[model samples]
Target: MTITLVQGLLIALLAMITGLDCWLQAFFIFRPIIVCTLTGLILGDLRLGVIAGGLTELAFAGLTPAGGTQPPNTVLCGIMTVVIAATNNTSPATAIGLSLPFAMLMQYILLFYYSSFSLFMSKFDKYAAEGNAQKFKRLNFVPLIIVTLSFGIFAFLSAYAAQAPMHALVNSMPQWLTHGFELAGGILPAVGFAMLLKVMLKPRYFPYLLLGFVIASMISFSNVLPVALIGGVFAAIEYFRTREVSDLKEQIKDIDNGDDQDGI
Candidate 1:
């Protein structure tokens, strides 16, 4: 399934927008799930796109940067995953492993982008010192444009040129290795979940966490949306219950204060 020039350009445009959205708009189009779905749409395979996006999204969910470090590039990873799956007619799960290298590569690209853009800091300082708001704004916008084009060009070329070689490589791999990749892809998301739990679990939230696990285990995977809705309902209940309890405690404290004043 070869993508035409037009389709390739569209994919590039999506990449640019998603990359820019990460910092500029902060609208989260760079997220794996959304970007993958958009890529799938461009490739004329929405179902596969969603599946790839969702799996990758889970794998990437807990990978947000901390301490000034960037995480793997989900925008590039997601697009490549869907592209690989669509091109090779492989399972979306398998595409996860296939796209991993590209994700890491994009991560390095992002680091380089930051380092290169950092050179403009002196120019920005100069503009600021001179009170040249126009040059300052131009300096800022220049990096953004370059970053967008970098993302666009990388995604476009990867999607356009990598498909044939990638499919060939997968086909030539040993059966064991192929299976290993599939297995790795399937379990990758669990790592993200474990990371999330490590960060978020607390003694007070244990019950809710266990309940969520129980519900997930009992439900069919296809029914996750409904299960998520049920969880949302319970979460709302818990929130309101906690709020009311806090309010009641505050009222009791107020009453006690009133009694003290009367006694005085």
Candidate 2:
């Protein structure tokens, strides 16, 4: 399919938006529902966008950025999956099957960005020490936007260019190998998930993640209402308990001041 420059650029811009969505999604920066819905709208297929976003949402539902680790790149997974499926050619089932591998490939890319972010943080703090606030702030957005936009633009063009290569790669691939990759792709997330779980888990909190998975799987509601509410209640309780502890310290300080005043 020959795409005119304007058409190509539009496709790419839309892809760029999806890439931004991915970066944002790494932190759940924006809700997956909104981001995926927007991408689907740009693609002129809201149904696929929402559907892709919803499933992608569930896939990473248990993950978050707590002490630094974030979920795998579900934003890219949803965008690429939806775009490929929305193509007049591919069926939704095929698109989802394809998305499984693409999402895993994206996980490596996530690690790369994460390492790069660590480096950028060092540079950013150096700028802050020098009192170059503007430079430090610019450093924050520029690299993020660059990496993100590139991911989208490259994926967009590559989807077109790689069709032939991907076909050849798949054809030359042994039946067993392809099956193995597909099988490994599913198995691999549990590894990243386990790593994430290792860091983020508290015995009390871990069960909620499991509950979210269970609820999402069993219910067809638009969102994980029941289980998410459970998480929310727990989080709120945790918050007030922390605040209560903090309040005690302040009260102790006030009492000390009063006692000192009386002595004076």
Candidate 3:
């Protein structure tokens, strides 16, 4: 579980890239699924990374930031989960619970950054008023640099400098405590999915949800690909049906307008 300096640097570089993407809300490679997989690749354990990524992704699926509110940092959750699991030879589930504190630390750091960066708003406004686009653009990079550097430093520390302590801590945990974490980790995805459904589920989509549930329960497969494929087909059908209904409505509206014009 010795993380060499080169590996640590590579991970830090990955963190910086993903951190920038997260800030920009650009390509969402910052998601746990992608982050974890890449981290696993760097650590020479792609399978572990894929497994952990899938679990971690589900756990984080509903924890997206809303407006000014920040959820636990997804990037740290993903990286630390794989790192801890691989380093300690622990289960991914256990690593997930252990990684929570790191995630929260990043969450708080981001909140602090958000507040501190607000102080620059006046400067931005001043630049805008004076029509100094060059200064404004240069100033914009200040926050981005700070955010990415923080990510790199913290990621390097967590994955390399702190690896020994993290490994020791996982080893010292009581069996019951470890089991508890595993249980919680398994349940978290369901809870996250429920939270998502609470926000997104509508009457029109209820049937599809029910259908998916039934199909999933009735078919015991090695993987979810078959179920996903079936769901995709249904989704396509729904899309086309909805489009047809919309077209029909538009046509009726046009016909009514024409009749009214003729009568006039």
Model 3, range 155-256, lDDT digits (tens) per residue?
A: 999998998888788899999999999888888777666766877799988988888889889989977788889989998998999999999998898897
Q: What TM-score would each prediction reach against the true structure?
A: 0.80, 0.59, 0.85
TM-score of 3: 0.85
Q: Clashes in model 1: which pairs?
A: none
Model 2, residue 9: C-alpha shift (Å): 2.7
- Model 2 misplacement above 4 A: 1-8, 21-35, 63-71, 88-94, 104-107, 113-145, 164-196, 204-223, 230-264
Find the number of clashing residue pairs for candidate 2.
Answer: 0
Mark the 10 consecutive residues where model 2 has the least summed lDDT.
Answer: 87-96
lDDT tens digits by residue: candidate 2, 82-120: 665554334443444466566556667767777777877
Question: Which lDDT values do the candidates have, in the order given?
Answer: 0.84, 0.62, 0.89
Candidate 3 Cα outliers beyond 4 Å, as residue runs: 66-69, 251-264
Question: For candidate 1, lDDT tens digit of each residue in 57-105?
Answer: 9788677764355777888889999998888877777888888898888
Clashes of each: 0, 0, 0
Model 3 lDDT vs. the true structure? 0.89
lDDT of 2 at 115: 76
RMSD of each candidate relative to the true structure: 3.7, 5.9, 2.9
Q: Which candidate has the top score in TM-score? A: 3
Query: lDDT winner among the candidates?
Result: 3
lDDT value, residue 115 of candidate 1? 79
